[model samples]
Target chain A: MNIHAIKAIYRFEMARTGRTLFQSIVSPVISTSLYFVVFGAAIGSRIAEVDGVSYGAFIVPGLIMLSLLTQSVSNASFGIYFPRFTGTIYEVLSAPVSYLEIVIAYVGAAATKAIIVGLIILATAALFVPLEIQHPGWMLLFLLLTAVTFSLLGFIIGIWADNFEKLQFVPMLIITPLAFLGGSFYSISMLPPFWQKVTLFNPVVYLISGFRWSFYGQADVGVGVSLAMTLLFLGLCLAVIWWIFRTGYRLKS
Target chain B: MAPILSISDLSKTYDTGFQALKTVSLEIEKGEIFALLGPNGAGKTTLISIVCGIVNASSGTVTVDGNDIVRDYRAARSLIGLVPQELTTDAFESVWATVSFSRGLFGKPKAPEIVEKVLRDLSLWDKKDSKLVTLSGGMKRRVLIAKALAHEPRVLFLDEPTAGVDVELRRDMWRVIRELRDTGVTIILTTHYIEEAEEMADRVGVINKGEIVLVEEKAELMRKLGRKQLALHLAVPLAAVPDGLSAHNLELSDDGEELIYTYDTTGERTGITTLLQDLNATGIRFRDLQTRQSSLEEIFVNLVRTPS
Candidate 1:
């Protein structure tokens, strides 16, 4: 209910993103752009297209999702973790702000940053690949939902991580590999029977597939199921965060 | 008038089973400087942390202006401004922005004039545009105080506001604190400096072993506990005290050069006249005599050493 509090926290975080411009926005866009060049040259020559889209265009949605997931998680996680590291979190915890408002401000700012990065990558991708949007509304929805979900996950990681080394553990050891194997580069349908079945178990596959379906109208799974899975993950993150505040875990102590 | 803040049976037992507080209770008047004095690991910080809601209380009830700190936390917290012991602030943000942002965190509407006034009062108006990382340690401490005052709370808790600063900065901080107190803000500070309490606090609370050992008006406590010592220099060294002076509380110096007598400042008759007459009658002559009163530091040490 404290609107000013939320704005203060939100604006402060957003200002930090602006301050670390290269690390926050430019690096992810540039790295995703490099993916476009290397994959377009190396893989585009061998395969003409995956489904009806060109090989170059096929990875655009997937690459954007890759950066979105990573940046959202890292941004929200570091946003909270740095405060804890410096012992400045006591300021926010003692303020008039509630736990839900704290979560909303941090996660919302992080998602906003991730969404902007996703849009910029989309624009950058257009310079190389001939892309088409089948459903712009659904694409926006997918982008917003994925950023919020991953940012919430990052918020949890921030609280659970006690040290700087542990802060980078999940993004490096778990998320990157999942993004690579989640059909971000090549469609899971192109793999053999057993490998395709194995790829389906990776949760990232559902996110990317649902997102890509809104682009080319073709996907590895039904759009409805992918949306449901994302909501389920979002709910799970919410439950964990609610428990964190209720029990005063890591934050209150 | 009701106390601005009231705490009853407050306690905190950490997960590790360490009992940090044991049924501690306190009340703060609306416009007075109160000091909590204790040594390290004496739970001064823990007690403040619980009242500020940074640490959960194991069992207690706290009301700030009739607002329960736990049940109506938002309302209660809005009235409090805490300058914590640790130096923690956003190094990236400018002084003006951070202080302004802190005000908003208390749900107060934007008032640039108030922010400007707080900055000027803290002697930080010149550094308003400077980032915190660029500021000196003393300046950062000032900024922390400015941030705490940004909300204009009725009660302010300064937890060791002058811990590591130099003498000049400590004096400056004390002046700022006194100025705040003059504006009718109830100031509660925790410190290990007996001098600080003697110089500023109207009431002093000595906390030790997770309990308040003593709380009394500074003057009253000093009068009641303060003792005066009289030392007499003997013209001729004596191996033992004179038999006539046996009734007087006296101690012989090991070097056999002086006699010491201790007396209470609050006692109407210190018996000094009779003791000196008895010494003269016993053929004891003194070249010089000096009287000294015990300081708050000695009183604090004695209080902490004894079981409450």
Candidate 2:
């Protein structure tokens, strides 16, 4: 709660990101541009529009969500893992900082990076896809909410992870692929009816659809339902994070 | 004055079924240097961890200045600081930033002057701007100490503060520790080096096998447990111990070059005079004789070797 503690946490975490700042910010923008070049030019030229929005524009929200989710998770996970790896966690844990203060600081710093990367990807997509914002405020809302939600989830992952390998295992093998298959590049409607229903089971579909709803004012799922799913995921991630901090799971024992 | 930290019937058992601490009770008085001595895996770190609220105890309680460590952790933790055995600091951060940030963890208002003084005390002020990874191993240790002292806690625990430092840094660290003690801070240090505790501790506690074997004043523990060895260099090497000199516990060197007699110093008679008379009666003459008293290291080994 104290500014000094928050600043210290932010500074320490931001210092970690600062090491790869150029990568965190630039890589997403570049990747997004590449996607626009390949997917927008190659795929959009053949397919006019998926849901009354141009194919290039339709994929924008999902791409931004992909970048935001992965970057947020990676940033927060590494932010916390490095301390344990370098053995600096002992100093932090032994200090007078409470569990809540530590969690908020690291998660908040990670959310900051994820938000920046999301914005940059958005801007890059604008250059190629004629991106328009049906509801700019809602777009920001989903962006901030998803960033914070994933950041908290990443915090828990970092604590549970024992080493570097484990840190990447969950995000890379599980979360990223799930997000990609959950309709980041294509609309779930393009799939067969069976696959379309199956896509509904992928939690990431709700995040992307919710974000897309804010952008093009059209979604495979209801916007309110998408928002509900994001809030649900946020609550679930927060609960897990709170439990880790309270139990002193990997951080203490 | 009252003790700043009180641990009563504290115990910890890890999930691996290792009982690190058992029914350990001790009081660390304010403004005193208390040393915890033990062999590897004797739970010195566990005890410190429990007091600092880093590791929880399975049972019992630790109170720092009347605040229970678990129930009132915020207050208890705020009053104490711990320097871990590992020299773990933010490698990419400057020494000043790391130390100042540690101060902030306790929600302390910014006091750059206090931070500078602490760094200066630990000889880390010059390297304040240097990144931690750029410093040598000894400098990293000093930064850890500086961070621990940044908040100016009433109690400080150094868990093997000088495990692998060079001689110069070790001495300098002790000097700084002594200075901190002089300033009325309670310091509890755990070290593998017995000489550190021997030289600096006012009271020493020996822990072994999850139990506190003994806790006594340094001088008192030495007086009660220390022994002396009278090593006699014979003019002629003896082939075997004579029957007449067999009454005393005398050990002949493997090469038959010397005879050694171990005696308890606390006893009324050391039996030196009688042993010399017996040696002479047995027609044994020693060209030289020397006596050496047991050091804290020997006493510590003996103390832990005994059943707790």
The alpha-carbon RMSD over the true interface for every model, in angstroms, is 0.8, 1.7
Q: TM-score of model 2 relative to the true fold?
A: 0.92
lDDT of 1 by residue, A1-253 (tens): 9999999999999999999999998999889878877897666768777897899999999999999999999999999999999988888988999888999999999999999999999999999889999999999999999999999999999999999888899999998899999999889988999999998888999999999999999999999999999999999999999999999889886
Encode model 2's per-residue lDDT on A143-225: one tens digit a residue. Answer: 99999999998888888899889999989998899889988988898899999998898889999998998888888899999
Fnat of candidates, each listed: 0.84, 0.75
Please list all clashing residue pairs in model 2, or write none if there are none: none
Question: Candidate 1 chain B: worst 10 consecutive residues by lDDT?
Answer: B206-215
lDDT (10s digit) by residue, model 2, range B1-308? 76788889999999899999989999889888999999999999999988887787899888899988878777888888889898777667888888888998877888999999998888887888998889998998888888888888989999999989999889999999999999989999999999999989999999999898888999998888888899999999988888899999799999897999999888999898999899988899889999898899998887788877
Residue A32 displacement (Å), model 2: 0.8
**Overall local distance difference test of candidate 1:** 0.92
- lDDT over C-alpha atoms for residue B147 of model 1: 91
Q: Which digits, one per residue and each the tens of the lDDT, describe model 1 over residues B214-250? A: 8899999988999989999999999988778989969
Backbone clashes in each candidate structure, one number apiece? 0, 0
Instruction: Tell me candidate 2's interface RMSD.
Output: 1.7
Model 2 residue A78 lDDT score: 84
